[model samples]
Target: MRREEVVAQWQREYDSFLQDCMNRDWAKIARADEPNRDWAIMFEVDRSFINNAKSLLFTIENRLYDVLQFLLDKGADPNSSLRRYNSDRRCYESTTPLIEAVKIGNLESVKILLDNGADINFCVERNLSDRDVYFNKTRIRVKEPSDDLYIKPREKRTDDEKMYIWKYSTGELANMSPIQIAYNYRHDNIVDYLLSRGATMKVNIRPSGIFPFPFTTLGEMLRRCKLYFIKEVGLCEERYYALRTQVREFESTKKLLKGYEVRNAVPYPFRIVSTAVLLLDNSLEFKFQYMALYSLFILEYWNEIINSKTHIAAYAKVDDIGYLICWLVKETEYSKSTRQSLGLK
Candidate 1:
């Protein structure tokens, strides 16, 4: 179905659900039957047979604030987690209504959920795919023969010779949190509000690609900026030709230093340079991406770097890069000499 059709259906379902709320036995009317017993084990966990989203999640995704408020008041769980099978990944993925709100870029819905006791730091879990488990390009999984075949030992096969190999697909427990998801989806207002509410990073996502290790959202943003510099600035502008060596060194040093904590080990100058390019760039796309990187830094080291009293002081012991970030973010004036020293135009 088309996107509009799907949205319209959701609206219709929500309307019917809202109307049913006036009835005293609405709970019974919303409860799911068999095949969905796993998720709808409770009365407040009603979901459609179609999408398997909880009523609260569906309402939040659709931005139906009135219905959301009514459901929350009617005892719908603010921290309810829905576990549904992902056909694409061939495994179950878990999501919360708060995550849904963040994904839809609805700050109001996010605030409502958080205000109503939703877990601020909740992370969604998606079961690992075959490629993730094998660390390979192959996506095929070997299907073991039925246990019934093992029950009756074949002519030459002894029962003791046969062993059942149970393969358990490990899921990423530290999946993207609401704040991280907000950053990913470029919801700046939601990111700021989540930070204000004491949200922190809990994600450890590692895609099955060249960089097969977990990195912070800040590190990812830094890498993105570096790519932008290489492609747009270095290749396109003769003025930045001198930066090729610096960029290459930054990439190598980043890879070498990224032992365990990729975020902490990212070279300071590299971080500053990458972030500076993004911050100074005129592109609207880079501006949005910059906000995500900025928000991530705030969450990662708010007290130690961003909001620290000493970091911004004249005699601050912090790295110059940290001071520069804090300084530029505040939009303070920089002397011509200072701008030239940092190679900023």
Candidate 2:
């Protein structure tokens, strides 16, 4: 028989078996398998049937296990190359059965795939080509900002340009790890599950692939919390002032009121700043200075300045003159801003 004829014959037999299964005529389906060579494809690369099985598993259909068992018994490959399967218009890159299970949040199916040797760290292509074609038709041209302190102005857009930008930004084109997809979708349960299973949340994966500073998981967690006001507060006191210096230039004078508000909310900003300054006295460095400035900014916003007496006491106790200079410069800037705003100086 020709390939087309064989395919047609296989389709007939597979359809009959599918109908029997749907009608709960298990005996008929069991007896339906015959000597048709085309029918063998049902046990080989019937993408539609495999997708149906996937859907059944996702929906917790009662006969899913039986269907899966039957397919396996007939020689369906669990790790079959998805490139050969043509079914509903789902992306071919996402054809992994394990990925389907993950998308459906079917823990049972996931376990089954894992037990059957599915790759846990599999990297599937995302639908970038489609997005690229769409974007090519309507690209936007953005202009660089004229000033560092202000937000950059967006270029005027035609409808096509706007649509292109929206589609390009919203499209899922890059291959994301299971953990990243879970996070993107706010699937907290899946996120926790993947983490517990040893998935690492790497920030950079290009060129040199440099991990962010303070690389420990705990440090990363803390960074996400945004609670650490300054490098000095959580870091060694010796380097605190040095770290503060680096971030000082980026401070926004216009946003001082907001900074003061933040300072008032937390552990008094004064104590926080003092702690950082103390740390800076011990370890002076540009990184530490930058972190210290961040802490100071938080303290300023919170309005948590220490009284002069405590500030002086802490200053006197620290031995490093250079550290004091950096601390003094930050204090001077804060003082100038506060005085100007409050009419104190």
Best by lDDT: 1
Clashes of each: 0, 34
Error of 1 at 194 (Å): 0.5
Clashing pairs in 1: none
The 0-to-1 C-alpha lDDT of every candidate, in the order given, reads 0.49, 0.41
**Best TM-score goes to which candidate?**
1
Candidate 1 Cα misplacement greater than 4 A, ranges: 1-53, 85-91, 130-174, 207-345
* Residue 254 miss distance in model 2 (angstroms): 14
lDDT by residue (tens digit), candidate 2, 1-345: 556766776677667666666665666645554443554454564434433444334323333555655554555555543432224534335446555556656556555655565555554443433335654454332221112211111244556555543433333323334554454455556556666666544221111121111111323322422323332134454454454453454454433223122222222222222333323334434434443355434434322354311211111111122232234334434456643432223
What value does the lDDT take at residue 227 in candidate 2?
29
Candidate 2, position 237, lDDT: 43
